[model samples]
Target chain A: MNYVLENIPERALKPREKGLTMVMDKGLSLREVEDVLETSGDYIDIVKLGWATSYVYPKLEEKIKIYKDAGISVYFGGTLFEAFVVRNQFDDYRRVLDKFGLELAEVSDGSLEMPHDIKCQYIRQLSEQVTVLSEVGSKDAEKIIPPYKWIQLMTDELSAGAWKVIGEARESGNVGLFRSSGEVRTGLVDEILTQIPYEKIIWEAPQKAQQVWFIKLMGSNVNLGNIAPNEVIPLETIRLGLRGDTFDHFLNNEWK
Target chain B: MNYVLENIPERALKPREKGLTMVMDKGLSLREVEDVLETSGDYIDIVKLGWATSYVYPKLEEKIKIYKDAGISVYFGGTLFEAFVVRNQFDDYRRVLDKFGLELAEVSDGSLEMPHDIKCQYIRQLSEQVTVLSEVGSKDAEKIIPPYKWIQLMTDELSAGAWKVIGEARESGNVGLFRSSGEVRTGLVDEILTQIPYEKIIWEAPQKAQQVWFIKLMGSNVNLGNIAPNEVIPLETIRLGLRGDTFDHFLNNEWK
Candidate 1:
């Protein structure tokens, strides 16, 4: 693509396996979806319906179609899955995904204390027909799991037929991999990266500063998730070093 | 209007003088405007085309028309006013507003150091034609003005016939009325409220915490500005104490 400026950091094209941008759709109208797609559709990879919000949003099928037709993968938020599993209605939940003709799904136990093996069983079961993105880590900021435990769970989830394992930061970016104040836990992140492939874990970075930190550490191709809808273009700019925050780092790179 | 739940802490009906919500629009297309108005039009009082972004935004007139049709007033951001003033194109700026059929305009010296008398003169001049919302305080957070100076400028600007004097926090909630970290300058805000009516000043509160602080301190009817477009519904929830942040504070008030 011929952009106005030259020497911009390269961005991964659609159908990309890396530099993924997963936006959390709390709830948006069909027209809103069209507008977003018209503007920044190319930059988006997956659009996850946030939490159990999909259950309350109107016109779920039409909205899902709007996203899928744009080549963006659509999935129910893991909270919605947990909500179903807690009620012992996993079959009913599968039927709902079928009703929407969804090809992607998320399996998570962020809101529940399900056994690790049981969670992996669900991931393995769903992987037969859909692309499963299983999330590791608790949603509660106080529920700090050891870094080794996070690595172990993620490794098992990936081996259990999961397409990618998501690091749970919640939509606020203030839990799991981050502190209650939304600051990323440096040692925990560093430890996880040592054992896991960076390309396989999508970091939930819902804030600008958090996005900057990840991009600076892993460059433009790092997979990031839990992005708010309106921030897509801004995040893409940050990725390409168009914004002032990351301008000097890329422009002054000694080895271009 | 009919709502899912009644007894929402009474929101001041629009065309209202207080409890005003001014959202910052940083170049959204017309369809996006329609979707937002369809979902949360009643919650918005005014839409400020953010910074000088309008200069580059396509279909500005159509977007402005959409906003006005929704009964939400439209004004070029104060940065645009400063842009025109710096280039000595205030007449051209007036012409642009007239051509757009705008009834509201912003007068600000946040970017340039125009004499206070001259800034007030623009307010006085524009007030004869359009309702002026003059902004006080510099956009640079480090250029701190003493509390007494903040009070004097706000009071003088209001007397000069500004419909409302905007406390200049910019859209980031990191300058003017706030510290670099988005913390409110408590003494300055308190002193300003002492001299100027809370209803006559719109505090630029772009962050959720800032919105909470204003609502909890000034009560629900405090006018707020520089709110993000997507945040309109959330802000209304905050205003009505529907959200957890301020639920107990207003719900348990004796008035309810």
Candidate 2:
């Protein structure tokens, strides 16, 4: 099924390096997951079982199979990893991932406070076993790390063998790069972008306005995470410049 | 399966009144709708097929059957009625509703410029045939009617035999009794409440914060509309004082 907006640029299909869209699965049923993939599968590259929701869903295996069948990479949210780490069940976590056929893993100290060296070590260790994605920044707004520290953390994680470093924005786009009003802190985004390689980072932008801001600032190829399942088509429209937000940005651009 | 907060302010199950939660369905698949209903079916009173999406979805009968099986009332959005009225196919729209087993309908003049008398006439006409819910405000924020006019519209619609009058907030909470920041325009809400019966109004609040504000300002039994399918449980939690926002509010009181 060809999407209506096929003329726009930077919309690489599956196995894409640029314009990657990651969806957040917050306790969707197996059939719901299948229906989502059937309708908007082409636009999604990765699916993150959001926060601690993976522990709640009864039929996790069935849900994983549905996503796998649709050629979408599935991974647990960073908070889930923090839960495992806090419980001292990292080995058990790896075993569960292997059993469930999950190829990707997120390593972050979003909830649980962990030292930078320890965080980097896990990133390196996980990279040897599976594709590792490490996240920077705390979930709590009060404990927000400076932009320089975030850039440094991104560098350390990438060096330690993380496939991509994620900037935490949580489920609500109120904290981390965003203010209480959901607007991106422009200076913070600029400072982080100046130090970090944009290609190796996936920014957690859960809102439409946030997605539009990032796409406008970093181009359509900017990797985005925590997208709602239903918003996949709308996000794709924004990425391809079909949506009003980024239409002018890519209208005259050429696709590789 | 019993939910975690089952004991909290036990709402009337399916086919309910008073504490009604009407979800806005904007082109969701059959499986997606079923998944949402499975988890939060008990809380949902009505599901509005948002805007013109009902006319666009494939296998409309199958979708309606799924909602009916879950014991939920399915209705088309008011915009569809306006569309039908524009095309001079009101009879055809009624026949389609009967064919699809839809029991509820919305009569509104949000999109088109219909006279107040004509709108009230349609509400009376629709009330005779089906469960008619008349909406009071326009979709465009710039074209919003004053508080006095809204109160008059609500009173007129209810007098014309409509079940409930819904205030237009569109999908985004911004623009109608809500500021550009999605905060409730307190002055406007207060003015409208003074003129209209609280029991007769169903405020369309699509955002979680907006839902929280309504539950906090107007008690647990406040009627709300345009809720997302997944948010049904969360909204119920807030209404019942199970979530942190309301838990802090009601737990300190004698209600706990």
Each prediction's fraction of true contacts recovered: 0.04, 0.04
Instruction: Report per-prediction Cα RMSD to one decimal.
Output: 8.0, 7.9
A107-207: candidate 2 lDDT, tens digit per residue: 98765567889989989888888999999877666776777888788888999999998888877888777887788988888998888878788999999
Q: In model 2 chain B, which range of ten residues has the least summed lDDT?
A: B1-10
lDDT tens readout by residue for model 2, B148-244: 8877888888999899899888899887767777888777788889978776789999998899898888878888999998777557656765443
What is the per-residue lDDT of model 1 for residues A1-256, given as tens digits with 9 covering 90 to 100? 2113345678788799999999999988888788778656877899999988888898998999889888999999999999999999999998898988999999999998999999999999998878999999898777899999999999999999999999989888899989998898889989999999999999999988899899998899899999988777667767876543465446542211
lDDT of 2 at B195: 78
- Per-candidate iRMSD: 9.5, 9.2
Docking class of 2: incorrect
TM-score of chain A of each: 0.96, 0.93
Question: Which 10 residues in a row give candidate 1 chain B its minimum summed lDDT?
Answer: B50-59
Query: Which candidate tops lDDT?
Result: 1
Clashing residue pairs, backbone N/CA/C < 3 A, model 2? none
Tens digits of per-residue lDDT, candidate 1, B1-256, equal: 4557756777778789999999988657678788889888988999987765555454677788898888889997776676556556678788888888989999987766678899899999999889999998886656999999988888899899998989988768898889999998888888888888899989999999999999999988899998988998999889988899998887655674
- In order, candidate lDDTs are 0.85, 0.80
